[model samples]
Target: MADVLGLYNYWVVIFLMMTGFYIVISRRNLIKKVIGLSIFQTSVFLLYITIGKVRGGTAPIVADGFEVYSNPLPSVLILTAIVVGVATASVALALVVRIREAYETIEEDEIFEQDR
Candidate 1:
């Protein structure tokens, strides 16, 4: 049962990644693109967290008599990645807003037409 649950979680993460990628590639709306990017970033974080989990390990914090600590590297890496993702998302959203203001529309094709 536990293995099945773990596998299900992995599948969900994979689906999130694929869905996010498809949205980013196929959507024409600037806001939708940013949303997709955010989704993709979040899915990666989920992957990291999932990988970090131990079957029966405890927290990595050192204690007087603790044993079998889960790896902390993955959590730290994911934290850093999440911060970077937020920064990237913010910049992308700002660019989208600027494009909308300049072109009077959020559609990618419309923005490209205005650019040309």
Candidate 2:
């Protein structure tokens, strides 16, 4: 039970990831799909950050008293990913706006029906 409790964060990550994936796959609205992708991206970020955490660890700075220094690479990478994710989401939203303008509806099935 204690061992299972220790992995709570991982379990949360898994749940969020699956929920996001299910939203993306099952939703028909373009805006909803983008939201789902954002959720999925956020879960990935959480997973990476969680993985980077160290018990009894300090920041990766050289100090005489500190020995267990946490790695900074994962944090740095996540920062970059956050920037990219925001940009991608903005682009996706812009595309969705354009799609709504052209199709008069943001629903995937409606757009397809119009096309046909």
Q: Residue by residue across 2-116, what tens digits does model 2's lDDT show? A: 8998799999999999999999999999989999999999999999988888889988779898889777888999999999999999999999999988989999999999999
lDDT of 2: 0.93
**What is candidate 1's lDDT per residue for 8-116, written digit by digit as tens?**
9789999999999999999999899889989988998998888888878888899877777888999999989989988988999899888778789999888788788
Would you list the clashing residue pairs of candidate 2?
Answer: none
Q: Top TM-score: which candidate number?
A: 2
Runs with alpha carbons beyond 4 Å of true place in candidate 2: 61-65
**CA lDDT of every candidate:** 0.89, 0.93
Q: Which run of 10 residues does model 2 get worst, by summed lDDT?
A: 65-74
lDDT of 2 at 99: 95
TM-scores, all models, native as reference: 0.86, 0.89
lDDT of 1: 0.89
lDDT of 2 at 9: 96
